[model samples]
Target: MQPFVDGRYNMSKGRSAEGFDSLLVSITSNTGLTGWGEMAPLGSFYSAAFAAGARAGIVEIAPHLLGEDPRALTRINRLMDTIFRGHPYIKSALDMACSDLTARAAEVPLVTMLGGQENDMADLYKVVTHGSVEEMIANARRIITEGFHRLQVKVGGKVHDDIERVAAVAGSVPKGTVIFCDANAGWTTYQARQFVDATREIDYTLEQPCVSIDDCLSVRRSLNKPMVLDESVTSLEEMLDIHRKGAADGLTLKISRLGGVTKTRQIRDIAVDLGFMITVEDTGGAEVDTAAMAHLSLSTPEERRLHAIAFHQWVTVRTATNAPPVIGSRMGIPDGPGLGIDVDLALLGTPFFETSH
Candidate 1:
């Protein structure tokens, strides 16, 4: 059996600077091979489920890897897919951990193995606040001065309010910088369309303006500016559909959201094939995903300026002493064994292991 440690970090948001944390996993094999991955949804309860998922994935998949060559990762991933159906996220998390170990054993970086090189990076931005026009502009000003022209602002649940939210954030950014408003599915089609119409004359993208993909497309077809799908596109099939139907012109690809790097790459291929924009961003906060997300986005050619990944460690964590994953003005692909990150195990607080037979 392998011992996988979880790093739970409490990070605050720059916009709100509220304390947010996530559970990151460090899976170690008996051979001293270790791979890193971040589990989804931040909370103590979410960590419990993430731990459960990791244990389940490792217990079921690790044995097959015992005598087999770890370099045969493709075969192992395929086996996991076939053996454990409908567990892509959990499987992906496991695959990322194992891939880190495999590449380290071979002394090769994960990017090269996946036919990738460190290039094209993106600057990450987070949703600051939901308030009056002046307040939104103030937040936008602060973000822009902090080297973030790319932005994502929040909107409450109301048609009138959503419109104001869009206009306010748009007016706040430096003349040419990009800005996007995340309704987080807080608007109705009619309400979303009003805001989408407003976006046509601005310098930003619209994300999850409405509820489902169906509603999103309904609004997107009537607009000139492209839309980005996040909560809606959580899988390969969803990505294919969005690209085929033109429901969305871009995507916010988070490794944790789409499982891990393996499937995240698959989604990237799909997006690239359809000539759609792809942004490899993280799910927010101090999860190990920040590093993995940076590497994945930096490695992909299509995700250079289109991606929004940056140093949020300061606000997220009190002390971000680790040189903040810098990649160009935005973020670039990192070169190293596994995710090219050295995790300090001692940083993780009390970690407990739970096994499932």
Candidate 2:
């Protein structure tokens, strides 16, 4: 609905200003309950996924779901995979819709449907978009002033400049505040080590410093700070391997990246069992996406849950009413049935196609 940027976050994946190309889906139950789902690609080049591909895949796979039970989430997911292998983002919306439908059918919230509520709210982290050292420090100051103790600083530029930007922001924030230097897989193994060495005096987290698993593992050996993985972590198998290698101390779990909440929570459970902290979120979407993320984060153990993002706020328009607000430094969640919010279909526009049996 809106093209927005939070500083250098748009640049991390070597993309231009990014826009939300979302596919909103609805699955209606025989009992008259409706569930909504959304899948929005960060950018055409950010990942292996793109909006056009997601829509085309949806068109191909959605008809197969017309006669199936909406509550059979695992079955539905498997059927989609059976019909269309790969392209996890394509099934993300359908999977989300199934979860919403199942929760509504049971008269419970999505979190309760997943299991039960393990938390009510989630700590929020603000992104410090790319800019000069001075500009970045100014942004960090304002973010900290807004009560955000956790910050994800965008780095991965020139090593010297990135070091300067990271050090400046780190020096400005108060002690005990969590600072994560996210390179978004822009750095090489050598660059990752250089940045880590330069910032050894500062206490901050490193995220996906290099693109490859081996590259990240190499970087991991050179530093004592906790490393968080994002781009390289797209599958359960990859997560298990990372755990086996002890490459990540924390993980950035995107619901869309992992397909949907089912696989996302599956990976989350694996992380918790292994004692790795997590940041439950999605690539990007409006209210529906945020609500789904909120419920998932809410159901995660507090200690293991690093923070959840209100991605809708990054969008210029509002898609759902009654979504949790980022007040102070926490995003509040409402305990209501299903997604617990109403979708603005008018803003979403008319559906491209529909079918019923």
Candidate with top TM-score is: 2
Candidate 2 lDDT score at position 8: 26
Question: In model 2, where do residues sit more than 4 Å from their true spots?
Answer: 5-9
Candidate 1, residues 256-283, lDDT tens digits: the string is 5666677787777767767777777644
Candidate 2's TM-score reads 0.96
Clashing pairs in 2: 7-129, 8-129, 8-130
Q: By TM-score, how accurate is candidate 1?
A: 0.80
lDDT of each: 0.61, 0.85
Candidate 1 achieves a global lDDT of 0.61
Instruction: State the local distance difference test value for candidate 2.
Output: 0.85
